[model samples]
Each structure stands twice: as C-alpha cells, then as structure tokens.
Target: MKILELIRPAYLEVRRIGNNIRRSIEYSLSAKKKDIKIAISTVLGYSEQTIPKLINDLKKYGFSGNSIYVFEGGHNKIEHSFAGYHYYKIDHNSFDLNGLITINELNLNADYWLLLHDTVTIGKKFKKMVYTCQFKNFLGLKLLKKDVSMNIGFYSMPLIRQNSEYLHSFKNTDYTEKGLLNAKERGAIEEDYIFKNSQNIGYVHYDLQYRVKCENDVMYKGRLRRMEYYPQLDMTKYKANFVTDKEWIIKL
Candidate 1:
C-alpha cells in the first residue's frame, strides 16, 4: 500500500500532463479548420481594457477574421485596430439589457451571432466544442444560465434574430421572471427557459473557466458579475435578478 501510494502522485501528474498535451493539439487542429463564421457582439461600459483582451483571446481560439460589434455605453469610448477582424462601435447611453438590445438592433451579418459580457473570457475548449454543434436549425448555445434567466450575454445569432420580438421586450426590463415567462409563452422550450436545463439543450456546454473577474478576485461559476462602480443605467426599470452566493472582489 505504501509503495502504491508513493507512485500514485507521479502517475496522476503524468496523466495530467498528457491530457494537457492532447487538449493543446485539439485546440490547434480546431483552429486550423476554422470553417465557422461568428459575429461577436458585447455591451461595453467602463471595461474598455477587456475588449482588446477578449479580441486577442478569441483570436487564440481560432475566431480569426470575424466581425466584432461593440455597443459602447459608458463615458469612455473603445477603439481597436486589430487586423483580419472587423470591429464596429455603436455609441449609446443604454445600460444592461438595453445595451444588448441596441446590439440586436444593428442586425449584423454572420453565420452565428455571439453575445458576450466584457468581463468574461471564452475558453478554448468550450469554443471548439460548441463550434461542432448544429446551430442552424436550433437556437445558439447557452454559455451561462442561472436560475430563470438564460443570461443572453453569451448566446448566438439566428437564435437572437429568431426571438427578437421577445428579446426586445426586455429592453427596459431585467432578465428576471417576467422576461423568462414571456419567453416560455412565446414558444421557448424548458431547456431554453432556464440555465439549469442546459444539458437538455444538446448543443450547449457550461464552462466554469469562462468566469467573471473583478480586481484579483474571480467567480468561477455563475453569470458574469457587473462592476459595482459601473452605472446601473436602466436596470431599475424592471425587477432585479437574483444574486448568487458566488464570491467576487469589486475594485473600489
């Protein structure tokens, strides 16, 4: 038993290293294939620093030459010159859900429309895996689902366009009960209604590493956490969504 225990750590370490190498090779091969055309849209408030980092991160994951539509809603504006990737900026005073609605209004063109939060980073494995799923007939993959909210911040296009009417209804409201119930009434399936049923969605994958970070603190789970100092804008127009118990460090 003592000898077996002594060899266990090294064996596990070797396995971990081998797994890492395999994942690396898979990521590289996926990047090389690069057949999907994804248009990324995100609401940017004061987190201008995150935009460039996000674009760079996506490039590393093989999302090259894609269009990035940034809806700027804060006092500061974000401008980028990343080649091979098309970037557009829409100046707006909206906040939260409204900003996302503004992005939808643009009607950008792409095979898939990816909605993302400024603070959350897309994982390489998650991107590659979702890329293989069938997104044409069904709704896009749900990146983060919590409680009754589907957290539209990390979803895709035809899904966004197909459900525009219902999504636009939440422009001035929060993504809480009313928005969800409305979605269900409009023909959204149980899997589409909440984040808890993500596994039932088939094409969706939950990536814990796609996290929200504030300062040095990070919440490896849950939807992206908004910064405290960032203005809530029109979030008060609707009922507040439930806050999770996940730990987040706010830089004040």
Candidate 2:
C-alpha cells in the first residue's frame, strides 16, 4: 500500500508545528506502507527563517524517504481569525485543495491520502485504528461501495486508486459565488462545509485520539486535556452508527 499525508503548517504556531511534525514522524514510523510520501504545504508569509527550519525538521523527523515532496504556497493565507490570532486565513474563494491533488501529480495515480493539519498528533491507538480499518476494507467493507464518500478528520483515511478520478471530477465542477456565500452563512465552518457538502466528496468520522493546541490558550484553558477525537461530540445517541471509541466512520 502507498500512503501520503498533507501538512499545512502556516496556520499553526511555531512551537505547535514543531510538536505536530514530531508526532507525524512517530506516526509515519508505525505505518505499514510499501511506499510513503509526506506532502507538506507551507505558506509564503511565514518568516523566511521559520519555514525552512520546519521543513528541515520534517526531513529529520523520519520522512527522509525519496517519496517525500514538499509543496509551498500562500493561497489560503489568512491574516487573522475570529478569535483574533493572526494565523493564516481560509478564504472560501481563494482556498484551493485541488492544488494538493495536483502538486505531486497526485491526480495521476491512486494512493491512500491522509490529509492532516500541521498541529495534530497521531499516537499508537491512532495507528492501530488505520491498520484495523485497512484490514477490514481490504477484506471487503469499502469494495461494496459504488459512489465516492469522504471520511472526515485529516488524521487518517482510505482512498482507492479511483480517488484520483474523484478529485478531478470535483475540480471540473462549478463553484458559484451564491453557493459559497450560502455556505458561509450556514453554521458550518469554512473547511468543514466545503469538505462535507461538496459534490462527490465522501466523508467519514475518524475515531482516533488527536491532540490540538488551540489558537488561543483560552480555548483550552480549563480543559484537563487538549486531546479528543474528531467531531468531539457525545456518541451514545448514535451508538448504532459508531463504535463510540473510533474515528474512521464519517458519521451516519
């Protein structure tokens, strides 16, 4: 199996990015891939001093294989957030995920792509989750599906060789300003709305422990721990749809 992960570090704090990269290295080591590619994307606005170090650290942190490719861009750059942290922004109009698919000519071949934030960590339990999911799917779970569904959380996901085809099909579709505006008006956050509601995008909720350092210490100020699974909600009501402790299903 071939694996690849996309890392966007510009929106994350330097210290947080460092730790995230460290954890990514540890997670990569635990993966069972015949070939792996770490596709890292950084912004153009980051201090020239910091981006290179971060890239070097990525290379040092166990992603030195020839398959690794670093792609840099500033298109999604956001100068501020609603909370007031001046991190990169996510402009609904300017953000382009197609670039991620195109950067390494990812559209040319089908590979299991794991999209990730630069400030998240993947530990043993998380690694085990991916392995188990792949095992089950390899045994038949995903093969039965005909349409493309997306799994949420950038932590881990399974994309068949045809995922590349799905990406291109999505790219050719039109993006209406009215639709974008309506999406922004909705309760959905920019990234979530785009990834979930978009055409041909199948999503899954990953039940894995992920650690995040919020843009503000205040967001996590009183929390005993800053780690939790994606969707971060009570699951008892939907027990039939989830394992309660897992993160790979895209919510029922």
Candidate 3:
C-alpha cells in the first residue's frame, strides 16, 4: 500500500516561504520508504508571484504525481478569486472536517495521507519515527489521543495509513465546539476549535521552530536553506531526535 501525504497550507499576513516549501518536499521524499507517493495540497492566499515559483521548485524535486491539490479562501474571506487558480475552494473552516473531505477526494486509493504544511519540514529521522508510531497505532498496538487543529504544524506533520475506519470516525465529528473555545477566541482564530479537540488523539508533537514567520521574526537559517532541513530538532528538548545535522542540532 502506498501513502499519499496531503499538503494544505492556510496563510493570512505572512510572507511567501518558497524556501520552506522546497525543503519540506525534499524532506518528505527523503523520509519515504522509496515506495510511497508523496503529494502536496496547498490553499491560495500567499504572495501571488510566489506560488508559481514554489510549484516550479516542487517539480525540480520530482513532484509529478497525481496527488497535488489546492484549496481556496483567505484569512477570513470565503469568496473565490483568480489568485486561487492553483487551488480549489471547499465548504468549511481550516483544519476542520472540510480538510478530510478534500483529502478523501484527491487520493481515494491511497493507503495513507501524509499531510504537509507550507512551513513544515521533516528532519532526517522524522520519517522513521512517524512511520513506526503510525504503524503501531494503526494496528491497534497504540492509542493516539489528539486534537485536530487548524495549524500548519498539525496538518503538515504527515498522517500515516489514514484508512476508511479512521476517516469514518473523523467525519461529522465537530472537533471544534463552542464550549471548547470562547466566542471571541473562536472568531479571532479560524481553526482554534479544531486544534483543541484533536489534542492527544494522535502523536502530537509541538515543534515551536516550525511556526509561521513574521515580518520581523528573527531565526537562523541553519545549514539547510529549506524548511525541510530541521537542524534544530533536539531530541532532549522536543523528545525526538529527528535530525542528524551536527551543525544545526543544538545540544540540549
């Protein structure tokens, strides 16, 4: 069974991270078992000119499969636009049930969906750890209690072996509920409610470094120019040793 990872990215007031996208795809290909077909799903709303460049870079990394998808909608706007040419619009909020519906439509026969975000990059050892964890959970050897959030980190981390059983359980389930988050909080953020509900259900790892960049955000580029190169993946700190780059790995 081949796995097809989804790459749906939601952006609002962030600069285009073309380098991040490049590194992400590279890391995905590197982490695969040489048999899985990795695909990317992205939403419209980044810098208009950067989309084509990002796609061109992906092609260079051999993203020629039939699993690449795009979605429409902005930070809070739902109306479609030409800027959304590369993506499609769906009914729902970000990181909510609509995301699953989009994935199900794209790779209907895929054994798993490895969701990637616009800013997520997989370290050298990420694939090994995720695959092992996912296998155990899928086979009933482990139980993953998590909240399905509307963040890049949650969606892009790569879901493994997301079969029909999992989908059936995930559908119609309003992971985001009113009681979970305050009315003001929910209105302020798009997918806050979903993230709250998905907590502890999956192997949820919070890598703070992968957060979206701000206009004045200051971060070291590390050894890898792309976001895929997670050199700072400290095992002692993050509880996972997903990097082997000596120069970039911080001694925790």
Candidate 4:
C-alpha cells in the first residue's frame, strides 16, 4: 500500500478527536445552555403499541429521549407514560412528512433533532453512533437506499437542524414535482431531492447499511401490499372498504 493510504486512517482519527473537542468547547461556552442535545420526534398510528418498548430499550443505554414530541394521527390517545413524552392530536394518519412539518412548527431547542420511526428497533450501538454527530445537516440510520446502479433513493430520520433548508422544502407536491402523487411517494421524492442536494450528510457508524429495521409484534413490512400478521391487532379497522397506499390482508 502507498504511504498516503496507510496514513489516512490515522489522519481521520485525529480529525474526529479534534472535532469532538471543538464541539464540547462550543457547547460549554454558548450563552444559552441547551439542556437537551437531541430532540426526538415521531408520528404515531398503530405504533402506539410498540413505541414504549423501544423507549424502554433506549433507557437501558442511559440515554433519555428528552421530551419526545410525537404527532398523533390515530383516533385514540396514547395510553403509555414515559417522562418527557407528549403527543399532539392531528387530523391525518400517521404519515411522517406531515408529522415532520408539525414538529417543525414547535421550534424545539436542542443541538439536533432526532426523528424516529415508531416501528424501528435500534440496538445499543445507536447512542454512540448518533451522539457523535453534531455538525451534519442530516444523519440517518443509513444513507438513502441505492441499487447496484448507484442510484440514490429515499431515506428517513433521525434529524435536521431547526433552521434547515429541508424544513422549508415540504410545502406541497407543487414544491417539487409539477403534479401530485400519493402522500408517500411525494415524501419519498422530497427526501430524494434533499439527498441529492445534501449540504453535509452523515450516517450512523453501523455495521450494515441499516443497523435497525422496523420491528413490532407482526409489524407491517412491505413496500406495497401489507398483511396484518398480528392476531392481537384489532381487525375492526379493516371491515369497512378503504382506499389506501397499501392493500392489507387480514392474514391473522
């Protein structure tokens, strides 16, 4: 190996150390001390049944998700209690894009915003991988999905700064595309746009591209169609005819 290539790893380590120290000094010297470094935001639908379990897991790491501001899109109120967790009733389903917009209006005071998918299950590696990133415009569990063709695609959470360009990007379909698609596709397209124009992007130092995947008891796992595999879930929500992005079959 060339001498430059051999020294690159050492160079990166030095940079990381420098950045961490600079970050610490900046936080310490700031006039308004931010008690919370990360503000957690999420959208809830049927995810109500799963989030508390994830919250419990987060506690094991000694990382409290201070003041979880959730946008509730379901008819029912959240029934679990965790400190610093609150939900606001909204007029839509548990869609991430709208939830993000709603969260934006609140103007949370934190060094970073951590957006989370309710069904996503993260491991202990999550804390270290995420906390180290303080200077990026975007940080997610992974990069946008790419194929062998080197195509960048949709991505999701963990956060954006309070004054990011992304917070201003989601107005309507007219904001990007000329015409409108479904809400899901519109959000995906918006995310891809953000990825393409990424000012500064970072990823969690994960072994796999995605260290965590959506997981709940019989979680809905599909890009298109869905199946309600959990027998314990209320099937009454499906009895009436519905037009949805997913065609869910009551397999249970």
Candidate 5:
C-alpha cells in the first residue's frame, strides 16, 4: 500500500500528461475564441448589499457587464445595477432554490454557464480563465474534490447544452421538501465522479474557500495539486491556494 501510494502521483502525472496531449489536439481542432460564450450567473438573497460592488468589480476585472446575470431573491430587487447587466427575480428568497431555479429557466444562448456566489470574488483575467478551460462537456467544477463525497454547490458550472440532464436530476420532489442544496450537490458529486472531467482550469467552493489554519494543512498540498502552470494563476493570489497561500476566506 505504501509503495502504491508513492507511485500514485507519478502514475496520475503520466496519465495527466497523456490526457493533456489529447485535450490539446481536441482543443486545437475544435475550439475557436469566437465560438466560446460563457454566461456568468450569481444568486443574490442575503447579500443584496454586495451586488452593486460585485457588478462593478466584475466589469472592472474585465468581464463585459452584459454577459453577467444577477438573480435576486432578497427583500429588495435592484434592477439594472450595471448598464448591460441582466437582473431576474425569483419566487423564493433562498440561494440554493433560486440558483436551481435559474438553472431550470436559463433561456439565453451561451455555450456555458458559470455559477458564482457572493463569497467568491474574481479579479483580473478571470474571464480568460473560463475561456481558456478545455472542457467539452461538463457541469461541475473543472476537476477533483478533496473527497469523492464532498458536495458541489453554487460554484459548480455546467455546460448549457447538458444542463437539462444533470442540473435537473436532483430536483426535490416536493417543493416544501428540505435540504435542496444537499440533494443538488450530492447529485453533482455523483455525476462528476461518473464523468471525471479531464484537466481544465476552473475553481469551486473548496479551491478558494477551504483554507489552512496550520502550516501543515493538506489543502496546501491540495492547492498545489489542482494547479496548472499558468502565468495568470501565478500572477494573482486570488486564483487558488487559499489555505497553503494563507489567503483564507472570511465569510460574511
């Protein structure tokens, strides 16, 4: 077992290299810059106050305001916060429910949908990260969870074409049923494990939020493991290594 453990990373690395080559070939033959359209969506319920600033930051960080969608399920709905931003209202005021609702009702035409939350913030070159990712078909994080059992939530991004399949799979039978998030994320975890998307640059709730308290925290290794050699990732501390890099998120 010890020897196998020692050999696993090496084996995974070799396999990753092979997969990268295949992905590169596929990307070269199939992908074009103009063909990729990513729609950024976020749910606002408790954090309505932060929506305006978040919008400003997104535009300031290089995302066109028109490509961003804000779903409001809060006490107040502020429409057209940004010039081209799209605002929609939900029937209920719950992030999990509202988010899922947005998924079910996504009418816009885009190749992919990026689901973000209030806690996670993006900075310069963030859109480039999304555009550069090589996933052909997936609706979860780019790849990997700390454990197979970990649930994927708002941070999970799905391909628009395949949304009807996985996104709608975990819908609660009864509207009044509880633990909608648990149901949804558990479904995502199961689906992602079955799919096992190849190396693509993306982040989720954990990659940036699961931080280290002690110097020896495994997230240090986890962050190091998830990364690819990209200058943009290295240029910004906001990319990953939340724990290893001592950039822990303070939840509001």
Candidate 6:
C-alpha cells in the first residue's frame, strides 16, 4: 500500500498529460470562432493563499490581465495584487447568499461571465472553448444530488450590462440560513430563483476534483476522494476525468 501511494502522483501526472493532449486536439479540431469577450469572476471568503495560485494558474492558461475579477469576502483582505486583474473587497457582514452579493457587485462588462470558486482550476482548452461557444446560458457542470438545490461551483452566466435591475435585486434580502445544511438550502433557493426564470439553459460537464487539507493543516499532496450521497448516479456520460495524488483512503 505504501509503495502504491508513492506511485500515485507519477501515475496521476501521466494521466493529466494524456488528458491535456487529448483535450487540446479535440479543442483544435472543433473549436469555433466567436466574437465575444469573457470575464471571469470568483468570490473568495477564506482561501487567501489559494487565490494567487488560482490566478497564476489561469494566467498560465492564457487568460489576459484584467480579465479576471476577484471579490474578497469575509474579514480577510487580500494583501497581494496582480496586474491586469480587478479586485474588490466586500464587507464580510454583507448579505451574500452563496456569492450572490459579490456577483451582484461586479460590473460585468463582457459578453459572458465565468463564475468560479477559488478551489477550481480551469483547463486551457476548457477556458478557450467556454469563450468561443455560443451558448447564452451554460452550466459548466451538473450538481450532484446533495447539491441539487445549489448551483455548481463553476458556471457561465450571460452578462447583460443594461439589465442592472435584476442583478441589484439580489442585494435586497439577507440569507437567514445559519449552518452548512441550511446554507446549502439557501443557495439552492437563490439559484432556483435566478435560473428558473431564465430560458435556454445548457450544461457542459467536466471533471472537478477537490483539494483537502491534511491533518497537519496543509493541503494534501493529491486530490481528496469525493463523498457519496444516498443513491449515486453513473456519471460516466459526463466523460469527466479524475486524478488525485493520494490514495482513496482519506475521506473529504
């Protein structure tokens, strides 16, 4: 088991390389040209150290400066700033129901907005295709049963700058849910409220792995094994690839 553990990272690296190559080829062959601008935004509450890494990874994937917007939530103020990116600090006490407040505050001027969480890492081809695709309302990934009421961490929302009233309405009420379960309920309710009224929603499935903290309070070397809900669905149709550095021993 120890030997297998030592070999996992190398194995995952090889798999990631292969996946990247395949995705790159597919993207090159099928990518369509579009005259649209995309702005990426993320709401950060606690992961200050992880935010820079996320930004750097996005830059590595060819995202231009100032194209990404970071909205700081909670009491933590980001000390580091990157050029060509916009940053806004929202008071921790603000009425944010699963980042709605942060999302509402942004002046999303692009044709599309890619909403992300700090933990998610975007692939190069995925980023390119997302911008090039003509879908007006794209859900980057489907929510699991446990997340049925909430929106996935990554989603693409059509940006309509002229329709400011709809966005401003999110700030009208505060989320009353207290704990984690209730918070998720709040998210589901809010997302349903926002998405149910919209037309033509599409889904693009992709792999999204989680990074867990070790007992030492540091991020583990590999991906964390995702937990299973009551009845698991066969997600094979999504063609999502998952690779973690560690074994499937640790539970998230």
lDDT of 3 by residue, 146-237 (tens): 42223322232234233434443433322234321332133234333333434333333222233322223223222222222322221111
> How well does each candidate superpose onto the true structure, as a TM-score?
0.48, 0.37, 0.37, 0.50, 0.48, 0.50
Q: Give the TM-score of candidate 4.
A: 0.50
Tens digits of per-residue lDDT for model 1, 14-82: 987986576466556533343344443343434455567767776777655644555544223434444
Indicate the TM-score of model 3: 0.37
Report the lDDT tens digits of candidate 2 across residue range 1-252.
122223334435676677556546644553455233333333333324333443444444444434333333334432332221112332222122433444323332223444332323333343333323332232112111232211222221243332445534333221354443332233122334334433344223233232222332222212222333332211001011122222221100
* Residue range 131-216, candidate 6, lDDT tens digits: 33324344332333223322332334342322236555443222232433343333434654444444444433234332222223
TM-score: model 5 vs. ground truth:
0.48
Task: Give per-residue lDDT, candidate 6, residue 247.
Answer: 16
Can you list the residue pairs that collide in candidate 6?
65-84, 66-84, 149-188, 222-245
CA lDDT of each candidate? Answer: 0.43, 0.32, 0.34, 0.41, 0.43, 0.42
Off by over 4 Å in 3: 1-43, 47-50, 74-87, 91-98, 105-107, 119-252
| Model 1 stretches with alpha carbons more than 4 Å out | 1-45, 74-84, 91-103, 123-126, 134-136, 144-157, 172-203, 206-252
Clashes of each: 1, 20, 19, 1, 2, 4
Model 3 collision count: 19
Error of 5 at 128 (Å): 2.8
Worst 10 residues of 4 by lDDT: 232-241
Q: Looking at candidate 5, what is the lDDT of residue 74?
A: 36
- Displacement of residue 223 (Cα, Å) in model 2 is 23
lDDT of 6: 0.42
